[model samples]
Target: MNTTYRKVIDRITAQTLALTEKNREKLSACLERFEWAKNDLLLREGQVCKYIWFVDQGMIRLFYNKRGKDLTEHFAYEGGIFLSLESFFRQIPSRLIIEALEPTVVYGLGYEKLHGLMETEPEIEHFYCKILENCLILSQQKADACRFETAGERYHRLLQEHPEVVKRAPLIHIASHLGMSPETLSRVRAGLL
Candidate 1:
């Protein structure tokens, strides 16, 4: 693995638990590097998600089409992780589509290899559980925001929390993620600016 990739892997365990060099090396061995150019589709609807992807650089989006409209569900920036959770956990075809919104580099660990490692690696298991917990928390927060926040408030919250998304993602995706149309988002941005 490259130095940058090793650093990302090392930091995961370093933050919460100490693992032996051998174990860390074993963990590192399971990951594969992947790169995507801008506008690339990393995963399409109906494909089974085979990897848990960690962003080493750049951005990715998770979205699905609803009634012929593209609705962005989430964005993953540098140091973030994303996958089609339903498909990944259940090992089934996903309705969610994963796309690269920028030139992206990510480290992916295969599901089977990851689960095998989790069986023997306590630290990896802990990390796995943490990822799951974060996913659930994020989902709940988005649901709550939709219920409680106005479109402008949602835009502001997103700007505060993930400024990179506002700066780097396409305006259309941002508008959809905030549960508003592009024109509404434009007005919101204009009013705020």
Candidate 2:
């Protein structure tokens, strides 16, 4: 196994659910590695998401087109797992697009393989369930931030919690994720400085 892939597997096993050595071996066999250039689309709107991607290097962004504007939903950097969850689980077309923000390497677990693993191993199912729960928590946090926090406060919170995003993501994409205009984000950043 690649060292990065092994680290990812070990990290998940530690943080999510424990997998037996046999299960881990099975999972390692199922995972596929992929590399994408910056701006390459991993999942496009109206396409079914077939894989859950674990980022081993670089970054990806989840976004959607809304009334001719791009609204960024999330960013996943190294050591993060991402997918169009609704589409992946429901086998429906995705409403969002996932794109590589930089030259990226990811380990992808195909849906069919994941399903088979979950069917055979309860531990895998539990691990997936925990991942979904974390996704829901993140969704709720974003909603709450948009609804209750001022733009400045949200930006501040983002800086504190995800400084990598502030440092690595484009300002326009960061503004979109924070529900602010680019100019507003620039002003907020200037004020902070």
User: What lDDT tens digits, residue by residue, belong to model 2 across residues 19-51?
Assistant: 888777777888888999999999899999998
Q: Assess the local accuracy of residue 172 in candidate 2 as a C-alpha lDDT between 0 and 100.
A: 98
- Count residue pairs with overlapping backbones in model 1: 0
**What are the lDDT figures for the candidates, one per model?**
0.88, 0.89
Using lDDT as the measure, which candidate wins? 2
Instruction: Give the TM-score (vs. native) of candidate 2.
Output: 0.94
**How displaced is residue 18 in candidate 2, in Å?**
2.3
| Number of clashing residue pairs, candidate 2 | 0
Q: The CA-based lDDT of model 1 is what?
A: 0.88
lDDT of 1 at 92: 98
Worst lDDT window (10 residues) for model 1?
11-20
Predicted candidate 1 versus true structure: per-residue lDDT over 1-193, tens digit per residue: 5666567777656544566777777778888889999999999999999998888889999999999999999999888878899999999999999999999999998899989998988877877887777787898999999999998999999999999999999999999999998999999999853
